[model samples]
Target: MTKFNTTAGKPPIVVSDEDYGRLTKLATAALDRFPDVAEELQIEMERAQVLSTATIPEGVVQMGSTVEYHSDVEQRRRITLVYPGEADIAEGRVSILTPIGAALIGLSAGQSIRWVSRDGREHVLTVLKVEQPVASATPTVV
Candidate 1:
């Protein structure tokens, strides 16, 4: 089994209660098809500090948050973290079920984490910025 950095020394992570509930269901359902990734997601969920959606800090990475991160191998990249069905790598939307995605959830800007990829490659990613979704937007009717 791949061992991720989840010890006491690592930085803390916070997740919104709504996101946690959705992700937990998703992870549980994925266990039969993708046990490894599902297990990792479960571990992350278990270690996360869940809070009310309104109480979660603005900079924390959550579903639909656009994150700018620097990776050991990939340098810098900005990606929007989304659900499995919404994932489109070509469009820079990463799925929460992926290794990097699971590792990023609940982290705030400047927080760094080391995670192992499915192929057994270790990577360190530091979140540079987090852009949370706007709560309200005006609709333009054409």
Candidate 2:
């Protein structure tokens, strides 16, 4: 598999210590489960810094401005793309463990990636934008 290259001239991203810790833990566990795969992911995740959407706070979204990548049969979808806390499929949020999620985790807007499907067709997508959760969007009783 071709490793995605990090872009140049990007600003440093900011992620909370807690979120960084969580990502580290998750990456560690993944490394144990899939040594080679985990090794690759570890390199990406460690180098990644989180940057949330305008609406969301840095601590809450564990996301960065960079794009991540993954490829697997449909069966591996759920495990790879969604966030650890956002595994509720009904909500339409995917774990970073999912292929698409993996492909998007560290990318910023305008970045693109290429991956192959089971049918041997190449697929590519660019980060049009990132919409992190915003604190103001949270409803609170007055």
Candidate 3:
């Protein structure tokens, strides 16, 4: 069994202003269609670890993650967990609001998460490795 860090007393995750706005709208709309789901989302938001381009954990992939998953649907997918307005299906950049994206959040290499798509299809995704993105060495002239 993998021992994931127990998230206790950790500050709630933060969302970008843009992302928060979209989430707020979605939450409001869901209040009528899926009240329980909306509430659960609220909880996730409260416990979320907010990060900007900076808060992205080192050695962890944020949006624009190109990883290989081995599951019932074994295939190489360049998955991206982006917010609305940032999602590009053409590039395989899935929105964080999507089912697969929701399951992939916070997962690291060797970790597997079971997910059911919106169509009720079940699948498991195991993160094999994350390609390190090249960081610009030049310091910004602030």
Best by lDDT: 1
Residue 31's C-alpha lDDT in candidate 3? 65
Candidate 1: segments with Cα more than 4 A from true spot = 136-142
Regions of candidate 3 where Cα sits further than 4 Å from its true position = 1-57, 131-142
How do the residues 21-118 of candidate 3 rate in per-residue lDDT, one tens digit apiece? 45556656666765544444444454556556565555454444555556767676666565545778898777655656655545566767666556
Report how far residue 12 has shifted in candidate 3, in Å: 15
**For candidate 3, which ten residues in a row score worst on lDDT?**
1-10
lDDT tens digits, residues 18-127, model 2?
44566566768876654444444455566666444343342222442222223333322222234556465665566555445554555555555554333445567555
> Can you rank all candidates by lDDT, best first?
1, 3, 2
By TM-score, the better pick of 1 and 2 is 1
Q: In model 2, which regions exceed 4 Å deviation?
A: 1-18, 34-37, 49-82, 115-122, 136-142
TM-score of each: 0.91, 0.52, 0.56
Candidate lDDT scores, in order, read 0.88, 0.46, 0.55
| Top-TM-score structure, candidate number | 1
Between candidates 2 and 3, the lDDT winner? 3
Ordered by TM-score, highest first, the candidates read 1, 3, 2
